[model samples]
Target: MIRLHHCHETRSMRSLWLLNELDLEFELQIHPFDKSLRSPEYLSLNPAGRVPALEIEGDVVFESGAITELLCERHSPDRLGRNPQDPDRPDWLTWVHFAETVSQHSAALTQQHIALYDDAMRSPIVMKLEAARLGKCFEAIEGRLSTPVENRDYLLTSGFSAADISVGQAVYMARHFVRLEAFPELAKWYDRITERPSFAASLPPEGAELLYKRDFYEVWNG
Candidate 1:
């Protein structure tokens, strides 16, 4: 069985969601943030001290994006991945990479506003500027999703894929930092993704304490 070193409230949630989507049984080892991920034991598994590290056949794998790909390859290869032999492989690979890249930028902006920037650095002006930049990213997504209702569903090809899992999680996190209401198409897309059984299951129960808690610089001031 695969062993997942999961940290609550982090990108690790994506791994768990993906595993649940695949219906693969795996061991989950919770690594609470208060416990210090840099501990020698955790470091032995991932020198970077990140969570959602997977131990498969005694080999450790880190990075949420990579782990999602690995799980798809191992368990739900048919559904999660495109056939390399297919002529559409290029488009499939492009969408996969696009999901990761766009989501990274979106998540980075959130971290900047919520955790990385201080009060002196995060003025209203700065916040608006950052919001505008993030808005442009959503605009791009909105354009793609503007396709006719029947053709607008998934981020990847016709059906659900890892792209949806990755991009969906990033968009979910974006709500905490950016106002997504301006983009109707993106908002609709987000609503659909969040309603998925896998996505809904991944979220913590309402009012429940987060799995892992980190000190957000902005939260301290407010």
Candidate 2:
């Protein structure tokens, strides 16, 4: 049996979207995004108390990148994941993990804007800095999508894959802090990939408590 511990709008959504794409039969256990993740039971699965803790085939995978690799290795070594032998493997791995680079900035911005409740606790400097970093990430994706290729639809020349899902979900979170209007290529690619049914399935169900209450967070000057 496969089970995924998820929290709405968290990085876990990446796994959820991939699972949906893979058409895998898995149970999803939704958790609130809060200190409750530090509970002993949750910690037993992922010592880091993260949102995504997958239980599969009597083994557990904690990290989102690891889970993406393991799931693709076991289930989709060709389609969603490029095996080591595949020519696109290097670019695939590079783009897949690059999602975290985008996510780290979003996480910091989230903390500065959402996590810290008090105005005194929030850092305008940090928010602006991280948001700028997210824009840089967007620029990288724009450059990739604009690369000289027959059809620059997805991140890889090989076409759609988990790499898009990985970076796509990270963008989903990062978008709350950084607007996409400046990066036309990135915006177009994001719109294209997220149109998949799998992406829609991973969205928070109606009435679910959303991690991001606002569609965009305006960063104030320090």
Candidate 3:
């Protein structure tokens, strides 16, 4: 049996989307995104105490990127993943992992804007810095989408794959901190990928606890 440990709108959403796209039958164990993650029970699944601890065939996997690679390798190698022999393999790996690059900034901004309970506990400088970094990541994606390649609708030339899912989810989180209006290509790509049924299914269910309560968190200048 395959079971996915998830928290609404967290990095784990990437794995959730992939599972939906692959049409895999797996049970989802939702956890509150708080100190509970560090509880011994959850830690047993992911020693790192993070979201997206997948149990498959009695073995567990942690880290969103690692899980994405393994799932695609085992279930959808040709479509969601590229074999080492495939020319797009390197690019695929790059884009797939780059999701973390985008998420790190979002994680920091999340802490600054939402996790901290008081204004004094939050750092305006850190908020602005992290949000700016997210913009830089958006610029990188814009460059990729704007590449002169014949059809750059997705990250990989071959077609839509786990790379888009990974980065798309990261963008989903990052958008709460940084707007996508400036990057037209990135915005269009995001809209296109998010329209997929799998992506839609990955969204947090109605009345579910959400890590991001607001649609947008403006960067503080103070």
Candidate 1 C-alpha lDDT tens digits along 94-189: 655555555565455555555554656545555555556666777777877786657667765467777677777766655555667788888887
**Model 2 alpha-carbon miss at residue 172, Å:** 0.6
**lDDT for each of the candidates?**
0.68, 0.93, 0.94
User: Which pairs clash in model 1?
Assistant: 8-212
Give candidate 1's TM-score: 0.80
TM-score for all predictions?
0.80, 0.98, 0.98
lDDT of 1 at 41: 88
Q: Candidate 2 deviates by what RMSD? A: 0.8
Ranking by lDDT: 3, 2, 1
For residues 63-178, could you state the per-residue lDDT of candidate 3 as single tens digits? 89999999999999999999999999999999999999999999999889888888888888888889889999999999999999998899999999999999999999999988
Candidate 2 structure quality by residue, lDDT tens digits, 49-144: 997999999999988999999999999999999999999999999988999999999999988888888898887888878988999999999999
